[model samples]
Target: MPQHHDPGTADAPEGQASKSGFRPTAVAAVELGVVGQSVGVTVPGASESVQVTGISLDSRTVERGDLYVALPGAARHGADFARTALEAGAVAVLTDDAGARLLALGSDIAVPVLVVAEPRSVVGRLSRLIYRSQDADLPGPSMFGVTGTNGKTTTTYFINALLQAMGKKTGLIGTIEILAGGDPIPSLLTTPESTDVHALLALMRERGLDAASMEVSSHAVSFRRVDGVVFDVVGFTNLTQDHLDLHGTMEEYYRTKAELFTAERARAAVVTVDDEWGRRLAAQTELPVTTLATIQPGSGPEADPAGPAGADWTVTDSKPRGLGTEFTLRGRNGTELRVHTGLPGAFNVSNAALALAMVLAGGADPAEVQAALDSKDPFTVAVPGRMQLVSTRPAAVVDFAHNTDALARALAAVRSPEPASKVIVVFGATGQRDQGKRPSMGATAARLADVVIVSDDDPHDEDAAAIRAEVLVGATDAKEAEQLDCKIMEVYPRDAAIREAVNLAAPEDTILIAGRGHEVWQEVKGVNLALDDRVELRNALTARGFTVLQDDGIES
Candidate 1:
């Protein structure tokens, strides 16, 4: 049996009170009425007096005196679990008016129900109220949010490393791990739910951090996972075709990402005008916008010149080297700084510049930014799955380039150097995602790689073979075009595919394993199994008696 409490007093027993921490603050007062009115449900329990300590979507995570939000999903209405949540010690339930009516008619639920229209929309405000109250007592570190279709993880890593180089205590939340100082915490999602997000921010606030960099995914933006929180700087790397399955269209996907910049709370915006979408976002956003670009030598018209003319910061004279990259950053007031990044790829130059712009916008010195870039080897802080080199003989690189645009970039980066060497790639499309991109990905891989091996990548209840067939369409097209003598192999098992690719590689060959960077688990038929691409590559290489080099010191 669960203990019931009056609206105003603490009801959980002894040690549980410390574990639960359910004391409600002033945000709850205003949120209750706003949510109640929005949903057309009269505030049933004490509105002015009632307090909710935390918000949760899962009934299993509900603690004593917490508010459980019952949202509707594709499979079922979350309100069905209201009774279970009450039994698990939930103080109240926030649901739609229709859901409340159903619950009222179904059973006599002792817990108070607050019904609102479009509960998901109002959830952001409610969560903001509940969590933002703690902002005064525990102000966040200078938080930075990075978004876009590609280069998010790499850009995030560079920013974290640069901040650390400038002698600031930093925390990171991205595709790889969550860091509080030097300790790494495993991540379950690229961007966690709003409640978890606020809780993590609260933890960082307690850790005396000076800065924090987080990856804001499209899903996070669309679902309001980052709602109610303020960002010191929000950056856009580039946008491409991905996650259309959830957003329904490219315009909607772009709009969902635009939410972060349009957000009234973002203090500054940094965008890469290398892509057209990025250029448009920079032009429309009202916040202080800084544009960056990495134009290859002798390229056509530069992507977005409007920002360089009107905006406060821009990057120019971009040149790539084998050791690192060199560029000139021009500020709005005619300030120029020669910047050298110890990271590969012309794309990385853009990522580094974005980080520099973010740090500068946050009041860090331009000289300090340059000093950070020069102080350490930029490659030292390489993200685990992004261009992560696992073998030396064939020089295999594992990256999370899942989409056509990102795939093209990764392949280009790999083939840029050693033009004579063959680029062999192993990749697969994700299940239940934008199926339109499948043939495009296949075509890209077939055109780029000397040997293309298609394998499983998070089938997730979708037919793995059918996904491969779609990818093969592009590969078939590439082969039919007579681009090169390309070999197409279908390996169902990812590990076996990796082994086969490595075994077939020569000293001059570069094998790129794409589609699952930094992820440790593979979801097949809804079950998450331990499967790391880097680990498997390393083990296979060692088993075959290959001496892997410390790092490939390749210049961009």
Candidate 2:
């Protein structure tokens, strides 16, 4: 049977607390009436003394003294779960009229019911009011938010690394993990829900972390996940085709990302003017904007000089440094800072450049930024799945390049310059996403890679075979139309595809496992299958006598 999961909501962990078990413990309970009135919603039958110390959107994550917000979901109303929220110690419920009626039908739900005209719209304001997330009196961490189709995760990781290099304690929120000066908490979405986001920010402040960096995805912006949080600096990586399933068009997607740069959300901006979208966003944003340009091999030709030519900061004198690259950040004001990243791929150079530029935008002294770069080499830090290296022999690597442009760039970045060395790429498009990109991804692999292997990537209730066939169509068409010399094959159950790539590879060849990086699970027909690409690549490489790198205490 096909398991139907809610597309609108993330598959959040089912518990009262996240893995970190960190929530605002010192919160002063706010009255239910006061909370409702703060968001312009009315609490009719609720007592004025009914107090809530926390806010939660998912019933399963409800804690004691929580205002469980029952927003309307696509497949089912959250009101349907109000009884469970009550059972999980939710003291009150905030929902729309439909939810109020549903609660009325469920007589056992006797808690306060605060009705709102639009429950989702008011959730952020209500959460802020209850949590004091952005109260001017409290000292909060300086927040940085990054958005785009491809580089959001890597850029945010770079931002956190640079901040740490500058001697500031840091927290990170992104697709891979969440950090709050403690152990890493695995993340489900690029950004968490507004309620959890506020709680995490408060937790960072309580822990005395000086700064935090977050990946602001298009879905996060569209779904109100980042509602109450404002950033000290916001960055725009180049926007490309993605999330069309949600935004319906490239224009809408660009608009959704641009929303994060408003004065309300961020104080300053760092725009990477490598593409027209970044140029448009830099011009259109009301916040004070700082433009950056990186002319890198992975980014292809410069965008006609309309974007990067007249930028505030430009990456100049870039040269290859082993597997990585070394570049100079030349400011228009004659300030030059040397930058180097051990991470491979020209795109990583761009990501590194953006990170350095953003730290300066966030009020870090330029000399301090330079000192950090010189001392720590922060941009060279290993970002878990963004171009993570697994083996020296065969040069096995994994990355999160699901979109066409990203795939093209990743393939270009990993292709060896050695004339005899081949690029074997194992990749597949995600199911239930923007289906239009699958063929483009296929053609991209066929063009750049010596061997194109189409495999499964999170089929998620969609037919895996059908998804593979779509990708195969593009690869096959490209091979024939362009008479490309790439060998194309279809493989199933991703692990086998990975093993096949290893079996086909030579010691000098490069194996790129794209589309799933750092992600440990593959969802198929609604069940999460434990599948880590790095682990698989490592095990396969070691079995074939390839020397693998040590990771997470696992000796090579």
Candidate 3:
């Protein structure tokens, strides 16, 4: 129900704009009776002339001529706020029998109440109908969705950049921000609710955008946030242990991610065969899948030139190009592409390759894609907070590496080859998340970094000291058990930890600030504190006489 409004961008209908900046300029209105019949529901005593122009789940954000969906929540039923929704100009209400009964207990509301068996299940389908996003007569943008435990945000940004490189107007939805070819809107989730998703798609069509890239998280697939939306092409970056707190296990997490590659959700898919999960997904999905094998630095013997047999495309011939890497993408029939990414790490090479392959799999002309690669260098476009280089003297970098695998990759990517150079890391596990990953993250830091400073991340409704202690447990255990030669320390007040890292660094050392990238807020006890790692790191480095680069700009 929190809206980030940017006026003068589009001519929206009166009261059509809502939270998450989804404002369609027009709505092809549908009658309430037709909507009920479409979703196999009947509205008792509903007027045939009543029309629905929009849909909303939150009562506070219901627009004029909108259908308010009152789904039951864990704490309170949405029907309890029916009066608030009706007063906000909702034309009709859609709820289940329990919601209807809850409505009956209150003062009689005159709006139409359409009763359904499961209101949440039909919210997506109904939103699509009302928004007219996928109509045969009027098509929406070419949708591209990327899903994985890692690299989703960067891959989506890469996809958008590639589309723009090919002279296409692009929109993006991800953990960073929502861009509808205009000013960027702050995002609250990886994927917004079904209503906002459909509405934003319609807005993209209205603005004449050609393509849109989205980051589809496992939570979005499980929560029905992307139910009605189907992608022209879907992409899979390698999966690892993540979001186990939500899915309960690694198998369940994989199962939730597999939902995005279904025949109903996506037309085609490009799977990265860097791990067993990606290979299994490529083999199991019914969608036409193109498998890719990107050989990074530490992939061991399995990352050969003839990467996984039957791989439709393979990335090989990688060489260092300044701070980035130049790699060749070899495909079937002796076809190849010369790719370059002006970003650090071999993982970025994988991200760039996946972006290019996904664009090609979506039916872009190969010659045009190559031309874009030559002219635009789309893969080098800066993605906020993904290996963002803040300063050069100590080589301070900020990355969104929250999990154990990501932490190891980030630490490895920033290590200096000089024997005297040390790696200083400042990180901590997020509270109210998978607590099981705390020790592993600490262990990874201890094994990879020369100095590990465990600090507080978002400690939402949890003790910050307790969270830090758990991480220190892993760091201390790894240091003692493996006899690792790393200095481990516990620090508090995250900005102080950043300053500490900069204070302990020589010009030859590299400072890696892991976790909480691009996020400007830290939640503790349900209150958001202003905290941007890039900003803090820049200020700290500047205070220490180190040169800082502009936002996400890399000079190598």
Best by TM-score: 2
Error of 3 at 328 (Å): 0.4
Model 3 spans with C-alpha error above 4 angstroms: 1-20, 44-46, 296-298, 301-307, 551-556
lDDT of all predictions: 0.74, 0.85, 0.87
Show pairs that collide, candidate 3.
none
| Model 2 lDDT tens row, 109-130 | 7787888888888787777888
Please write out the lDDT profile of model 3 over residues 1-556, one tens digit for every residue.
5432221111122333444359698898899888988888765564766989999888767888999898887667888888878988999899999999999999998988889888888888998999998787997799999999889999999999999999999999989889899998777788888888999999999999999999999989988999889899999997877888899999899999999999988999999988878888999999999999886434653354444676888888999887788999989868899899998988898899999999999889888989999999988888888998887778989999999988988898899887799999999989899999999999999999999999998898999999999999999999999999999998889999999999999999999999998878788887777788988888888898888886554322
State the lDDT at 35 in candidate 3: 93
lDDT digits (tens) for residues 333-358 of candidate 1: 88777777655566767777787777
Best by lDDT: 3
TM-scores, one per candidate: 0.87, 0.95, 0.94
lDDT of 2 at 355: 84
Clashing pairs in 2: none
Decreasing lDDT order of the candidates: 3, 2, 1
Model 1 stretches astray by more than 4 angstroms: 1-48, 105-107, 133-138, 296-312, 316-323, 377-379, 549-556
Worst 10 residues of 3 by lDDT: 4-13
